[model samples]
Target: MVNCMKEQVFFGEGMAMVKRDYPDLYEAIVALNEAAYTGKVLDYRTQKLIAMGINAAASDERATKKQMISAIKEFGVTKDEIVDVLRVVLLTSGMPPFTKGMKILGEVMEK
Candidate 1:
C-alpha cells in the first residue's frame, strides 16, 4: 500500500482526496495496486513498462503519458525501451492506440 501510494503521486493526482474522503476505498485500491505491482518473476521496472503498454493499448492518453514520465524518472526507462513497448502495442492493439502512445511518448520526451 505504501508503494502504491508513492506511485499514485508519481502517476497523477487525486489519491489524497480519495484517502481523505473514502479511507476504506482508498485502502482497498492501494492494496490492489500493491498486490499487482509486487515484483516477483518480473521486476518492478518491467511491470512499469507493461502497465504503460496497457494504458497505451487502452488509448488512455493522460495515464499513458504520466506513466511514461514516471517510468523515465524512476527507472531511467529510455525512449527506445518505450518504443519497444509501443511496438507490442502496435501489433496487439492496432494503429490508433499505437499512434497515440507514440505521440504521448514524443511529448514526454520533448519535455
Candidate 2:
C-alpha cells in the first residue's frame, strides 16, 4: 500500500518540526492517519480524491495543489479526473473556490 499519511506528513517541514518538538502529538497524528487511510472500504485513491475535493472546496490553494500533484504522481490520476472533482467543488462550494481550485490544478499540471 501507499501509506498515504506518511507520504504526506514526511514531505513537509511543518511535520518535521512537529516530530522534533512534539513527538507524542506527531505519533498520535501518525496513528490517526493510519486509521483514516486504511483503505478498508473506499480505497486510497478515492480517499485521496475526497481529500483533494475538500481542499478545493475550502479554497486551500496550497493543500489543493499538493493533493493534486500527489494524486497524479502516486495514483496516475488524470487531469480530467481532477476536473471532475473540481466540478463537484463548483457545484457545492460556488465559483470562487472552484475557480481557485481549477487555477491551482492548472499550475500543478503545467509543472
Candidate 1 per-residue C-alpha lDDT over 61-92 given as tens digits, one digit per residue, 9 for 90 to 100: 87898789889999999999999999999999
Worst 10-residue stretch by lDDT in candidate 2? 1-10
Per-residue CA lDDT of candidate 2, range 1-111, in tens? 112343545434377788889999878778878888888999989999998898889887777888899899889999999999999999999999999998998899899
**Candidate-wise lDDT, in order:** 0.82, 0.82
Which residue runs does candidate 2 get wrong by more than 4 Å?
Answer: 1-13
TM-score of each candidate?
0.86, 0.89
Regions of model 1 farther than 4 Å from truth: 1-17
Which pairs clash in the backbone of model 2?
A: none
* Best by the TM-score measure: 2
Q: What is the lDDT of residue 94 in candidate 1?
A: 100
- RMSD per prediction, one decimal? 3.1, 3.5
How many backbone overlaps does candidate 2 show? 0
For residue 101, what is the lDDT in candidate 1? 95
